[model samples]
Target: MSESLQTLQTGPSAAAPGDFGWHLGMVLRGYQFLFEEAVEGMPAGIRGYQILSTVLHRDPPNQQALGAHLAIDRTVLTYLLDALVDAGVVERVPAPSDRRARKIVATDNGREILAQYEERVATAESELLSGLKEPEADTLATLIARLAMDVHRSQPGSSPCEAMDHLP
Candidate 1:
């Protein structure tokens, strides 16, 4: 097995010294739970919701452009779009500029679902950040956004750091 895989298998049950991987794993687990429990029924995960929301406000976003702006892989984005299409929350239309390219647009149902889920996500996040006051929460958000923009500007070929970035 790969060294990384082996380390993952034998690492401390909880995060330990020099265990950034373990901490990231825990964060992913928590995110999955929070998303599934709080936002699953809302038409998409946070990523999907963001895509739909963006498309609603800015329709006819070609897949490549969407992938670039959202920093999602085209392959993974294909599946996410498929799910949304299957759910009747979004539609893919052939791009007017390029027949080979397809654009994503939010359906009416998608808009409603996204709206509902956004509220739920806000509630869940507020609960998670309850320890901080409103001003602190706002400051944290601003700082995180700045950090994400910096990382994105610096990383040319890297997929977005999911934790540091948001759907927008």
Candidate 2:
């Protein structure tokens, strides 16, 4: 077998299929697949979708503050924002308090696109979590949210996931 396959086979197995790590990897891959397939027509990838959604919810957030919140580095965030700006999905405005700071805001077109993507994403998520009942899914979400909040609180500079760096 290939080295990668052998490594996976020998790794830890906290869940049924493989170790917790393996399961996490599979889950992330699944999410990526769904996001790519579902948002094919959208101008942004999953990360862009997330950033657009976040900006819509929290309008006019400075680039640095937004990057910190989303755990995205300045370089990647710049590229993502540039793409969104090019697509007319988001706009960068001057900060009210700081002339040097640039704030991100979603445009009307961006909001409409996000709304469509939201429905698609929700459907995809429901399908992905079909193994769980509604209540179980809700409980799982709550638990995950709590854990995430705790981790964020404990780690001052750490973001949720490194992959999320593409989003903010």
Q: How does each model score on TM-score?
A: 0.71, 0.79
By lDDT, the best candidate is: 2
Off-target runs (Cα >4 Å) in candidate 1 are 1-32, 57-60, 161-168
Q: What is the lDDT of candidate 1?
A: 0.75
lDDT per residue for candidate 1 within 1-168, as digits (tens), equals 887766766745844455765655665566566656677765547678768867877663598888887778888889889989999998988888898989887788888888888787778777766878999989978987897688778985566436445422
Worst 10 residues of 1 by lDDT: 159-168
Each model's lDDT: 0.75, 0.80
Over 1-168, each residue of candidate 2 has an lDDT whose tens digit, in order, gives 887667666746523333565665676778778877778777658669878878888763588988888787799899989999999998999988898999998899998999999999988888888999999999988987898789888985886556433432
lDDT of 2: 0.80
